[model samples]
Target: MYLFKKAKESIVSSLHGDKSSPIIKINYICNCILKITLAICLWLSSLSFLALYLNADIINKSLFQLFSLSSLILSCLSFIILKRKNGTYILAKIKMYPFSFKDLVDVSLLTGVVTISVFDIILCYLYLLVAFAVFVIATCSIYECLDNPYMRDNENISSFSLSFISVLYMGLYVISNGVIFRNLPYNPLEYMGYIIKNIIEDIFSVTKKLTKLII
Candidate 1:
């Protein structure tokens, strides 16, 4: 029994060693922080739903929209600060590092968040094609980052990551449902599927276009 316990501990230790990589650490920390921000977003979304229930006046309604947008912007800024290099906005010190594919994916995800935020704000909360495109690619990128075998063997971290993502989606669903009921024309799940469909169509269209050009 003692030998078995020792073996188990050794295995656990080795599994955890993989998560110690700087890239994984940064990604995990960023995900944790984003999850917290998402919780706040969920709370605010609940309040917005309440305000709507109370039949708040136009100015109050406008303020709710403004605050929602503000929160979204802040959450996005948080992601960018942790994941990307920006000269103009200094939440953390600016430093240049060697470019890597993972970094490119992080940048692309951040770009999608920014682009989605702008469109959602300007179009009065309509989910657009670019938003859909960025969302899928970003998620795939993050999953790829988490694909290390040793890290995958770390059951605790794996559970935490799964829980965090589940909560994020739940929060998004609640907010999107609120938006849809309030006649904002955004159903989070439906919008996601729409985005996926568009992505497939766009890929096929691009393939056809390239083939025609070659022909």
Candidate 2:
């Protein structure tokens, strides 16, 4: 809730660009937490992408090694760009959309990496949930970025664009590679459209049962 409040404030501030306005200020402690978390996400991304590439032609190999390598390069670039505190200081400020991938958003995203890295068939099906999650996050992100004054700047857009593309790839790689269509129970790709919907319904069903039991 605090993060969302601050994110909302930052969005408003960007529209005004007023120094006095409360544009997403990252205090010492929160800033520290964000840096640490993003660093961990970046690290996991590196490792996961590397693992995927090495396992290319294996079950979990979703993306072409070339694409994985490109993602690695983008990660490295974003890392360096984000590390530079001066010009990139804007990142820590009006943070959302473009920078979301390189920022706090990756924490949730890393769960998909677990699915990709794990060899179990059951684990791979987690991709359905991950896909649903990515959709929600991406929709929220695009909503936040929409009509924001900060998005007008080409450089700022570039920063966000690069990070955004990498994240898109990450989300896509998660669903495409680690995911199986349950070919045995149905024809290939037959149930692909309903997979995520079914998974969500099943989750709600289980949660409802748990609630009833507790009651």
Candidate 3:
């Protein structure tokens, strides 16, 4: 009841452009906690479902593919929505869209749920732990960036850059781990080594492409 009241008050304040209201801050904090809790619950439930039916090879393979593909597509869509203007408008045009907010909360929760589900099937627990850690860090970074007064007030150092940085960090972690649709076994230490090699190669590749474009 308290949460409902606060949410209503926050919505009204936002509509009225009452940015100074304490309810706005409370709403933001509550919303973040709710999203994190939902994501964690969804992830744990998905894992449990998978574990309980591990013996069903056909079902297991089908679900693994389904969640993996869904996660990849949703992640890409989420990034595009974050980076583009009129993204919400675009999303609204899509048929049978379920969610209202196509922003951080939706993206984070879906990513968390699907990522853990997919990784649980293919990768070892260590890799799953790394992925979850990255997810948490990235989510927190985005929230901080959005909440930061300096970032919010400044046009130059926009929140989008911080969001992009968080995405880049996650991308690097994923690339280092060599996570793909095809499950492959690898040592965690070797994965770290691969990360360094991949980063250096990516830098050189980008440098060469830039030089070519300039020429």
lDDT for each candidate structure: 0.40, 0.39, 0.40
C-alpha positional error of residue 145 in candidate 3 after TM-score superposition, expressed in Å: 1.0
lDDT of 3 at 53: 57
Candidate 1 local lDDT, residue 171:
52
Stretches of candidate 1 off by over 4 Å are 1-18, 58-215
Candidate 3: TM-score? 0.22
Report model 2's TM-score to 2 decimal places. Answer: 0.27
Task: Residues 1-215, candidate 1: write the lDDT tens digits.
Answer: 43344455445656676754443444443345445655665565455455545554422344345444544554454444334333111211010111111112111222222211232122211222223333343344345435634445544343234334334544554454343233323355764665566567667878998999999
Each prediction's number of clashing residue pairs: 0, 0, 0
How many clashes does the backbone of model 3 have? 0
Cα-based RMSD of candidate 2: 22.4
